[model samples]
Target: MNRNDTPNGSPAAPQASFSLRQLSDADWARFGAGEIAYLRPVTVNGVHAIAIHGADGAPIGAAPNAELAVAAILQHEMAPVLLH
Candidate 1:
C-alpha cells in the first residue's frame, strides 16, 4: 500500500493553506511614520553591522547580522525593512 493511502486505499487528508495579510494604505502610512523599524548597514569599530532605525531617522538598535536585526525588530512587534 502507498504511504499516502489509508487503510481502505483512500487518499490522505488535505493540508490547510495559509496566506499572509495584505496591509492597507493606512498601514503603509503608519509604517512610514515611524511605526516600524528599518535595518541599515553601517561600520562600527571597523566591523560591519546592521543598525535598526526608526522611520523618523532615530537610532533604535543594532545587530551583527540582518537576520538578528529583523528578529529583534519583530520581537518588538514592529515591521523591519532593509535600507539602501
Candidate 2:
C-alpha cells in the first residue's frame, strides 16, 4: 500500500539522488543551457513539512515545499514558477 503505487497495483521505481545542497554555485549558472526536456512533478506531505518531487518519469530531487521544488526543477526563481 505504498503511496507511489499505480492503478494496476505495481510499485514505482525509486528516483535518482540529486540533492540541492550538493549543487555548487557554478552549477546553477549552467542549468538548462543547451536543450529542453520535460519534467514531471509531484507534491507530497511529510509529518512536519510539505515537499515536491522531480518526477520527470524519474527523480531528480525533492524540495521542502512546492515553491522550492519548482524553483529547483526549473532552475529559476521567477514568478512563473510559483505554485499558484
Please give the RMSD of candidate 2 to the true structure.
15.5
> Model 1's lDDT to the true fold?
0.83
State every prediction's TM-score relative to the real structure.
0.60, 0.28
Give per-model CA RMSD. Answer: 8.5, 15.5
- Report model 1's TM-score to 2 decimal places: 0.60
Best by TM-score: 1
Residue 64 C-alpha lDDT in model 2: 55
- Model 2 spans > 4 angstroms off: 1-56, 76-84
Clashing pairs in 2: 40-56
Per-residue lDDT of 59-78 in model 2, one digit per residue for the tens? 34455555555556556432
